[model samples]
Target: MTDVKPSCLEGIDANGTDSESAVERTGAKPAEMVRFTATPEKNGATVESENASQLDQATLMATRPNGGWKAWLQVACGFSLMFNTYGLINTFGIYQNYYTEQFRFDPSRASLIGGLQSFLLFFANGAAGPLYDAGYTRLLVVTGTILIVFGTMMQSLCTEYWQFILAESLCIGFGGGLTSFLSPTVLSTYFTTLYPLAQGIAASGAGVGGIILPIVYRELEPKIGFPWTVRVIGFILLATLLLPVLFLQPRMIPGAGRKFIDKTAFTDWPFVVFLCGNFIYLLGAFTPFFYVEVYAVQNKIASADLGFYIISTMNAASAIGRILPNFVSSYIGPFNMLLLSSISTFVFAFAFEGAHNVASLIVVSAFYGGVTGLFFALQPVVVIGLCPDPKLIGTRVGIALGFISFAVLASNPIAGAIQSRGGFVGVWLWAGVTTAVGTGVMSVSRLMKTKSNFFMKV
Candidate 1:
């Protein structure tokens, strides 16, 4: 057999040779050939056409490393980003509790700051997705790092409600949003079979960071003072975020011409209903993270110091939850795993209402965190699975997260308002009911996709 060059056309090449002869000699099928045309520019240089770039992506997608040093490195970068983004967000309960005690702010009003910050932390993804798809991974990460560091520093100097809102809510929220979702989107390009597992590993960084930051804040704020403690956090953000800014890589073509709202995604009933369930669940999800410490302290279930660690405990279990369930999901299917996780979360939401002692609260926190961790890890996997075009995953994920931003933004404040009139029981009951409804809605999506087969891997 002769070595033959695969060709898009069967006629003569630029070299005036027979293209069909080249194809026949190598026995290369038409589908296996690299598809592109080279056109000469005015400078007598040859440039591959846009079709070449598209073909390059398809080729890379099929052959991309599922796991290797390079691929796993992105996971590490993702972990670091999550450590800074959701890690800190998970610790917001500490801030809420602190502001309530020190400043005497209304829980409902103070929650607005956290609500705004959380809002942009996800909402920014709408714009960030298109930017990531355009190959601005480094730019987005670096800019987000700068803003996060700046916001932390600014938050140190803040003494007023509006000032905290400006620095923490606007600056940090937008900054973190730009970086937070990009890791999963990037990982989707590198891993196929191991996508969920890789995402879980990366997302666990939030759990680890969540566990540590609360301890740092609790221990340091008393000794170093609030401003200096916040500054310490700023320095940590600067250090950790530098890794992704330095080395994170996007594996797709620079421009796929995606829109922020994929109108097509909304038309798919399964996708629409699934997002609605996610929306309702999110409305209750972070409410616990923002209030567990406060609940423990106010109810005298634990000392203030011990109460703070409940957040850490939840996050530790959450780290385990993020990793193990996702590993299991690789075999069972992400949608199936999501349904199970949703049911568990719904159960835990109600279980919190029954806990009246220190031990019971801690147990509830652990179980709740673990289940929510699974939900967070599964988000990207489910979105990618639903997406018809792999190239549009980022955009579709961004749109889905836009719904989440509102859910989180309104969740805490609503909980706070509910707590003001009725107490934590009202909050707990609301969380449980919403999660239950969300679970039921999500079941609809699963059933629709699996053709109502209860045991399908779907």
Candidate 2:
């Protein structure tokens, strides 16, 4: 056997003195050595020396995220992206009302248009993610900005059903997808410890936009007509998108050789389980937002103006929901927060069935908004945790969201069809059942992750 020398030890020198002896000789307290120690029986002196060198190199190469003004700026840019993408999607009820009233389409047809928009917004991300990973983030943002502005402007001139579908559903939806996919993915690179809080603040911008845009449309549409009101909204998007163009950045250099779709991620069972649960959860996720205003009008719970306010009220509550739950989620894992939000959403969907008056309607809307906000804010973080490689986060998130987009696409129109057959009761019951099923699936995913450890943060 080779003899072990003090010089081969992690915290020893060529003088055959270890750190502890040196400390004592110099009358100094022992300091922790930042090196790996290897057992003599397991590895010889040469192997131990190599292990120590490898550990030193790893320490030198490791880089923690730089959280400062630059990082928060990325958060702000993420806020702007959410404001334009999900913000508008959340307020589709306002558009659905306008289209059915103006163009004389049935509720299902109107819902179909909104659902198509949501589908594109989510599905297009599959391509956008790979593009971003390949170093096209700037291109994606610029192209998306142009399409969204152009599409929104074109919407002002549309009168026919096909025209609206082309401008609103296809162009704007595709544009929103480009920006939305890049925003959170880039923001996540700037944080590890404070990720949940950063994402929550970024997502709260959607709540703020949801509250403001509906009120803007309600007040503007009456005075300037639908055409100019839409034009005004388009201009606001132009102004807000500038922030992302200027400030949104990625820390990793573009990996041009990397494939857009990472096939390896498919083998991660935990991630696969999470994706299945997410799809089920999203099936009923937006049902309330899409139909709540119409449901209120149908049930005589509120007037037209008050029905509009209901959307805003829910979004106002969502602003609080987005921030608080995320901050708390830092202490308890994101999956725990997601499980709680899923359970609460399941309960509140049932509350919609019991709502007969304006008071109960508003209460249920607020409560549902709060829980859903938690779902949205924590979603990206949960996916990040399951990801094995940080470089592939964009691709993984994009593909998962692309699959979930199908559920979002079909949900609203399905809810409308159910309402047509069974009235408001049918809609509420469908929403409740789907949400409950989603909750159960999510619970199973949690169990799979933690092996039924009820108190584990994961």
Candidate 3:
């Protein structure tokens, strides 16, 4: 075949060159040969090609997500993983009440165990992300399942404070963290446009778990006692965990030679500012989650069983909160939705301080659950938006989560101490003030990014 330059193929019809001659010379089909037009500029003629446009369209179609049974299955697995992990974390208030009553432990001591559990759940994500990147998705899931089962089962046998801390705080916390970190990571692989909504649905599993577990514990404890109640929960966890281990998988091959923590993310000012805001937000975020049952009991607002019902109320509302806000965020922007949710949380915290009666407390719990649920559903998507490079998203999220872990760790114990000193008033005040301040900081960061464009989606 003759080596024909692309320039020679142009204007073949106008220049009276036959189609056969052009095909014979260029070795390209008539459909494949793209036509270009030359336009006069100051320097020379600028050529524009239709072929480039077609190539771009082809690339987009090839990369578009296949949203079918497989993709939805990943979302289902994500839901189960969350149900077994953070869903159990959401039951901390119930456990807090149990530990205090059974062991005669002070609120501060009980909170220490809950706080440590929350800490490890988030803190371990920094390490788990890298392990997922290294192709340990299945390994991490299996190990987390074993640990969660073992920890829950062990909690049945523990009578000492230290033993409770070891089983519930360290073992369960570590296991949940490992499984939770991988849930969203694997789900993201099979989605693109519907990602936020899918993630919201998956994360709503926490709310579902939160509702079921507390109710189970509250009703079962009266008949079967604490040890047996916990054993029942352990069995439930086993059933929930098995689904994810069998189905959840990565869409791509495991990444190799990537650093566990990416230090370069710190160079981005928006991400750094967002991280600080998250830290401040979390300082007060978990207070209600850890103390509401105790607060109700201390104030004589309701009976023990009813107090547990309040937690279930919050979790039920949170399920709606998690799903709806995330779907809205897909249209309005993640940061904007976060700001609104954060403000709502702050407002509810203050309202919770004034809630002296059972009716008021129930109302507050519902609204608070609805508002705060957005934080978990929207946070990962917000972090991903701040990253300059898509490949570095996991690392950036890990670092942010690691930083937030310290805040979660300290928030419960600190609130417990404050409650000890000044009662629930002090705890509520702390939650309201810190969350409001965090919202303010996030607003400022948004301003810095948007400048004067108040209506900008960012």
TM-score order of candidates, top first = 1, 2, 3
lDDT of each: 0.79, 0.76, 0.75
Best by lDDT: 1
Candidates 1 and 3 compared by lDDT, better number: 1
TM-score of each: 0.87, 0.85, 0.83
Clashes of each: 0, 0, 0
- For TM-score, candidate 1 versus 2, the one ahead is 1
Model 2, TM vs. native: 0.85
Tell me the tens digit of each residue's lDDT in model 3 across 1-458. 11111111111222344445655555665445434333222122121234433322112122324477867888899899889888998887778767888889887788788778888999988888777655567778888999999999999999999998999999999998888866666655555556667878888999999999888887898999999999999999999888887877654334458788777777777778888988999999878876787789877999977887888898888888988877666566667788999999999999997889999999999999988887778777677667544344456667778889999888877886798798889999999999999998888777666664567775
User: Least lDDT summed over 10 consecutive residues: which range in candidate 3?
Assistant: 1-10
Q: Where does candidate 2 stray beyond 4 Å?
A: 1-62
* Model 2, position 36: C-alpha lDDT score: 20
For model 3 the TM-score comes to: 0.83
Candidate 1 residue pairs that clash: none
Q: Which of candidates 1 and 3 reaches a greater TM-score?
A: 1
Per-residue CA lDDT of model 1 for 1-458, tens digit only, reads 11111111112233334534444644654334433244433222222233444344434344345787878998999999999999988777788878888988887788778888889999998888766655566678888999999999999999998989989999999999988998788887777668889999999999999988878888899898999999998899899988887767755555545565678987988888899999988888777877788799888999977887887899999999999988777677777888889899979999999999988999999999999898899887787677655556678778888777889878877887798898999888888888989899999987776667787765
